[model samples]
Target: MTTFPVEQIRADFPILQEKIRNKPLVYLDNAASCQKPQAVIDSIVHTYSHEYANIHRGVHTLSVKATDRFEGAREKVRAFINAASTKEIIFVRGATEAINLVAQSFGKSQLQAGDEIVISAMEHHANIVPWQMLCQQIGTVLKVVPINQQGELLFDEYLNLLTDKTKLVAITHMSNALGTINPVKQIVEAAHSKNIPVLLDGAQAIPHMAVDVQDLDCDFYVFSGHKLYGPSGTGVLYGKQALLEAMPPYQGGGDMIRKVTFTETEYAGLPHKFEAGTPAIAEIIGLGAAIDYLNQFGMAAISAYEAELLAYATEQAQQIKGLNIIGQAAEKGGILSFTLDRIHPHDIGTMLDSLGIAIRAGHHCAMPVMDFYGVPATARASFAMYNTRQEIDVLMQGIKSLIEVFG
Candidate 1:
């Protein structure tokens, strides 16, 4: 494994240097969103200060420079995920918009009534709600594959759910709530055997590990930029070139059109067909910079270091009395979720904040996962590339102090 350089990584993010409530901030809410590095911030600032212009279809110097950066970002996204081509990468608001684009453009157009879409029990609501909306609109069926008590997806059961009528298999690459990394390559292979295309919600997985969409053989992959240390309201949708070409544009306007007339209009090809109107220009450029920053450390080093941090946190968290860890999957990322006896998760979050220890305490937009675990909510401490074991120790101290206060 390559040297992680955690301290140097921490230094890249300016926010990590601050003291919250007189104590150093121990940010453990990375699964929600990561703090931006100086590089990403500088990229955004530079774009706005010097190269601010609407992209594509302008010949002015600023427009040309801006367009180059915008298109260059698209190539960066393609390389980041090892996508086939820049044509396969579409810019959207975030993963939510990306999934909806697939559901509305692809799902609605191709799938007929009674066609089934297979998803897992551990999916984020973004994955679930779009399909539900599609079902309501088109009379399709949504089949959920169950998970074991450990929050791992039941592969055999998932296979059984796929049949002649199953149109697509849409699932998460990693669970934001539980941190369980699904067997995506296997999932894709199984879905492919039945000629079913698979879409993996990669918002949680992209930050914690390296993902190659080509290797996984997933038909479509979506993730939020903010989750990967980029700006909010910017994300990516990577689809197989053939699939993207076949699907109609999700929205109609602006850059998405090839030619528009009074009566007949032709849409743009590939990615531009889906990206309607003006996009978040500065944010997208910042995303490119964020990817550049991650590449500096190498994702393999970051993943290895985060794994060590997760294991250490899990061990320390399990030792605490009255704390019950949730989602103990064998294959997990750097997220630790747990419930404390006699203490509401909200209270834990509130108390932790007082000590400059930040953690998430809620359904994490995966309320179904919470219902499965028989808990209303869980306190989650998610690690990032910049986090240290010492931060985990501070979190441990906060939890112990909370438990004593409740008693």
Candidate 2:
């Protein structure tokens, strides 16, 4: 087992100390959501307790303070993804909403009848459904790039799908269901070769690795703050400056308008055009603090530690009889999805929970991938920097007990 500063990190999250059925909590459901550190919790409380005011429409001191904090969070998001400017970052409720915003605004503007929009088989419903809805609305065709049995995208098949008729290609940087880390840089380059713009669903990638939007050259990237140790109900969509300016506004409300007129109303620029009414002021501030907290730890260190944890868990899991791990992508993130012989994934999840171990069991919002694998669901254990080898041992023991009981 690799030695991580697990004790030191565990101390930062108070919720990890709680007991279930008199057993210490072993949180392995990080892919669903991560426990927040004190820094993030305190930041949220501080924002609401000390400075709570509506932003961008008032002249009062509190409003000014709120606006500054809110916009500062935008800058933090820009820096987090290495976006070119704050204008490229638009805050929404979560990755789902951010993706819908782009699909409705940018997609509606770009796609026409018989136009093609490509996505991967491993895409979450949030990434797939929005494009499908848009395609249905505009009479466009939605194409899916197939994945191999190992759950890795078939890049050659993806390349073949790109053509002059392809208007947009939406894909996931990392599969939330399978833990497949896709070659997004190469994917983007290939799509751009055919003049197709790419939108990356980064909900799974942002929390696990360092993402440089400029380096990837993707047209749009979306991720949720909750998955990155920030507050819930907060997310960001980063678009290239030109694309954001060209796309129409998502929602028409108070902040999105430049001037109100019955005859003709002008829309605000880049971010404001997308951000409608009063935003998630406190959550945005907390997200900024979360970014600050992660920066202090250094993303390189976090990535390395999570990779080690994943490898250790994989080795331990492979030792169990009648166990089959899914998504054996050459490049994977911190997620481990698997199944046991004749045992439903939901049963495995419930059994683990009895031992104070948390995991995700379902299609994980990627029903296509599940269908491709011919499985109803999978039990997923996702690790973070705070997870320890002891937790993995507990998980392994829990699985062994389950096998003995069910076998």
Candidate 3:
């Protein structure tokens, strides 16, 4: 195995050199959104500065150039996730919008009243709320598979939830709050056995690991670009070609239509059918640049390095007095969620920020997970490829100082 060039990787991100509170920035909130590499930032600047135009609607030179880069980004996303084709990739605002699109379009078309949609208790609000809205609209039932104390999904319970009534299975590939990496392949296989389609919320998983939608055989997969070290307001929804072809268009406007008339309007096919209106042209190009940047190190390298970082962080965190580390699943990603005795998470986060240690302090948009763990919020230090062992040391130092003050 090649040695991970962590310091070299850190150098590529311009924000790593930033100062917060007169101290070097230790960015550990990567699960919320990653710091962009210089390459991605340059790509955005180049696109808007040199070739800014609406794509797919104009025959002008700039428009053509913009369209090529935009569509090229879709192909990059396809290859990044090992998707079958570019046609299967639909650009959305983010994972939230993508989930809503599927819920509204596919849920309305294929499912009926009383049909069940199975999701895990550990899903983000993006994964939960959209389906709840769908259930309210169509009178469908939302069945949640439970998780154990360690934050691992009860596998038998998940399989039991898959029955004749279950129309769809939407679950997170990795928990944003818990750092739990669910057995997605097994989950997909169980759902597929019942001929049920599966959708994976890959917002947390995509940055740390390589994802092959075909290998997992999931009907749908969604991830946000910002979490993957790309620009905000850009994401991808990868669905099976046959399934996408079957579902109606998620939105209606502009390039999504083949032909329109006062009396008759026909929608486009496959990917274009779902991507409507003026998309984030510059951001999409930047996303492609982000993919190219990540390709240099490969996902395996990133995953391995982050795993090591997480292990180190966990070991140090366990030594902290009266600090209870949450989510001790057998398999986890890079998140470290915990609660300190006699101190609120917000206080912990605020104290850490004074030391230039950045972390997320809230329910993490996974209130259900918080409810399961019976905490109002958690202090989450999520790692990424650019993070170093030194940063973790800084984080631990901050935590220890905070505890000493509180104690």
Candidate 4:
């Protein structure tokens, strides 16, 4: 087993101490949502306890405090992705809303009849649906880049699909279902060469590895805070300042507008233009704290540790009889999705739960990818910084028990 302070890391999350069915809980569903640290929880509680007030409009002490806390979170987000300016960060509900915002504002303004938008076969529904809606609204065409049997993107196929008519390319930085880390820099360069803008769905990538939006030069980058060890109902959308300035406001509300009259109104600038109404103030503050927590342990260290865990898990899992590991990408994150012969994924999930081991078993919101593999779903066990090789051993034991019971 690779050396990591797993016990110390487990202590940071209080919920790991709980018992399930008289057994110690082993949480492997970090991809769906991570267990929040005490720091994040304390931040939310502290915000609600003391600094509860509406932001931006009020000039009073409480409002000023609220505004400072709220905008402070924005700066944290800006720095997290290495965005060009605070103006580039727009707070939204989550990655779902962020993609929808781009589809609505930028899609509406730029996409025209017969224009084409490119996406990958491994895209989540959140990334695919909004673009489909846009294509349907206008007469735009939606094209998909196929993935090979190894669950890696066919970059050559993607290149072939690119044409002068391609308006935008919306691709995931990492595949949520397959754990494939895409070559986003190369993808962005390819799209830019065609003069087509690209938007990266970064919800999965941000939590696992380092992401530099400026370095990638993607037109827009988006992620959710909940998946990054922060609060739910809070996410960020980072668009180039020039692109945001050109697009219209996503939602019309009090804060998004600069001046309003009976006849006409003027929308606010970049960040505020996209963010409408009273925002999730406490959750935003909690996200800032979560970022601070991640920063304490550098992303490089976290990535290296997770890579070791993934290799150990892969080697151990391969030793099991009749086990089939899915998505064998040359480059991968810490997600291990697999199937056992003649056992349904849901059944495997339930059996593992009986052993106090939690793993996700479903289509994982990428039905198209499942269809490609000719399976309804596969059991997924994703790891985080807190996960250790011993946990993987427990998972393997649980799987063996499940097979013995079912077989």
Candidate 5:
């Protein structure tokens, strides 16, 4: 009986009070992006209203205040993931941009022609596309480890894929569409045995569970703030100090230079070298506030609570006749994806929306996973800390109504 302060958690998110189509909003699209709590919202407002200034290169009062908040956010991110230093935390636009940065900057140098980068079959498009682009440019080959029908990675096949030619192994810590939690620590150990670097896309993992980069021993980790109940256009990329020093700058512009000249320009340090332009300053502060909000409840308790919710949803889902559930990985996060016998996913989403239940429908940016399952799309209901089992019951009722309507 792991207890959770469910009602108190729900009240913190003002948007939960929203009424959609005259029905109360039941938000279950957490894997895409989580709803912000009032703390995060207030932080964003405070940053914009009180301390809005470009970070670094400015010695003015507001600039220093803004830079403190911005860099303070970086420190929060560092502590959140247990990174060694603030130097390793490079704020990017989102997980998409974070992966792109590593691919162009680190992958370019580490991988030559005929080199291989290994990824899982269930990777999101954000994880897959950048490596493909890198391979296309450098003549490197991308290797994909297959997944079982349960959506778990084939570990033996992954081990087989790691040869001397393997340069990097990039994988998602959790599958956004499938909710499958990968064996990342084991994956890192296997890759390291071959002297291969590994990167984790933590966009789906951070909000649901506690993450420690040092314990995982992954060379790089990336996550988006928006998925962690923060704001859009804000993300964090964590790289080892040694790797970041060796890698070239992802982009060259303001704040990334120690000294600039007509002949030879000197680049700045680890993090600034990767961050090329003006960042999402206010959003970064909001992200720090989001971290604060989560810490109050603690991730362990949240994970436990969500597990109970997931179990309830899974058990209830089985009772719906003609409903086919996808991604039955034994160990998973709180995501439920399904397809009704005669209903398109888009229609399912629309019908659910009319009842004020928010769930995602489509390929979910993991077209490869969808193709593997032989489905065009699925309706996904992803849970957050604020979600309730009662909401799941409403969803079941809505789904049953759809079956009756279709019949």
Candidate 6:
């Protein structure tokens, strides 16, 4: 196993050195948003400083240069997912918008009354609500695949849920709240067996592990840039070429049309048909820089190091009195969620903040998972590649103090 240079990597993120409440900050809210490295930050600055202009509609020198960088970022997203072509990658605002794009464009055109869409119990609201809205409008129904107590999706039950009426299956590659990594490959294979297209919510999965859209053979995959240590307002939606070509334009506006007249208009090709209005040029370039940074360390090495940290944190956290850990699946990412007996998660989070340890406290945007577990909310500490085992020690100490003070 290759040893990760965690300390060296930490130096690249200036925010990690920040102090909170007179102490060094131990940021454990990675599942919410990862800290951006200097490389990504610089890329944004460089684009605005030297490469600033509107892309794809001008002949000026600045516009040509800016267009190259913007389109180059598209290629970066393309290679990152091993997509067949750049035409398959559509830029959206974030995972939320990406899901909406599929729901409104593809779902509206293909689905009819009494049709079915399958989603899991652990889906983020971004994956759930859009489909619900679409279903409500078209008189369709959503079939939910239940999970076990361990937060693992019941594979057999998922297979049984599929039928000819099922138009699509959407699932999260990793649970943002539980840290459970679902068997996405098998899920896609089963959905394909039924000739039902599958969409994987890659918002949580792409940051922690390697993703190959072609390898999984998923029809659509979406993720946000900020969660991957890039800028906000930028995301990628990877759709199969045939599907993208078949689906109608999402939101019609400028640049999506080839020729416009008073009576007739011709839409542009696959990706441009989906991407309308002025896009996020600088943020997309920053995302490209983030991808370049990830390639340097490789996802395999980062996953291995994070696994070591997760084990250490879990073992130490289990020793805390009156603390109940949630979502103990056989396979997990870097997230750890737990609640204390007779203590609210918000209170625990506030106390941890005084000690400069940041963790998320809430339902984590997955109310269904919380409802299933019978908990209102939980305190979550999710790790990343730059995080260290020493930080886990600090987290344990903080939790131990929370228990003592509450008593």
Local distance difference test values of all predictions, in order: 0.94, 0.92, 0.94, 0.92, 0.94, 0.93
Tell how far residue 30 is off in model 1, in angstroms. 0.4
Evaluate model 5: give its lDDT. 0.94
Residue pairs with clashing backbones, model 4: none
Collision pairs in model 6: none
Off by over 4 Å in 2: 1-4
RMSD of 4: 1.0
**Tens-place lDDT digits, model 2, residues 112-213:** 999999999999999999988998899999999999988889999999999889999999999999999999999999999888999999999998899999
Q: Tens digit of lDDT per residue, candidate 1, span 61-153?
A: 999999999999999999999998999999999999999999999998899999999999999999999999999999999999999999999
Evaluate residue 350 in candidate 1 and report its C-alpha lDDT on the 0 to 100 scale: 96
Q: Per-residue error at 351 for model 2, in Å?
A: 0.9
Q: How close is candidate 2 to the true structure, as a TM-score?
A: 0.98
**Candidate 6 residue lDDT tens string, 65-172:** 988998998998999899999999999999999999999999999999899999999999999999999998998899999999989999999999999899999999
Error of 6 at 178 (Å): 0.3
Q: Residue 279: error of model 6 in Å?
A: 0.7
Score candidate 2 by lDDT.
Answer: 0.92
Higher-lDDT candidate among 4 and 6?
6
**Candidate 3 lDDT tens digits, 201-256:** 99999999999999999999999999999999999999999999999888889999
- RMSD per candidate (Å) reads 0.9, 1.1, 0.9, 1.0, 0.8, 0.9
Q: What is the TM-score of each predicted model, taking all chains together?
A: 0.99, 0.98, 0.99, 0.98, 0.99, 0.99
TM-score, predicted candidate 1 vs. hidden true structure: 0.99
Q: What is the lDDT of residue 220 in candidate 4?
A: 94
Instruction: Enumerate clash totals for all models, in the order shown.
Output: 0, 0, 0, 0, 0, 0
Clashing pairs in 1: none
What TM value does model 6 have?
0.99
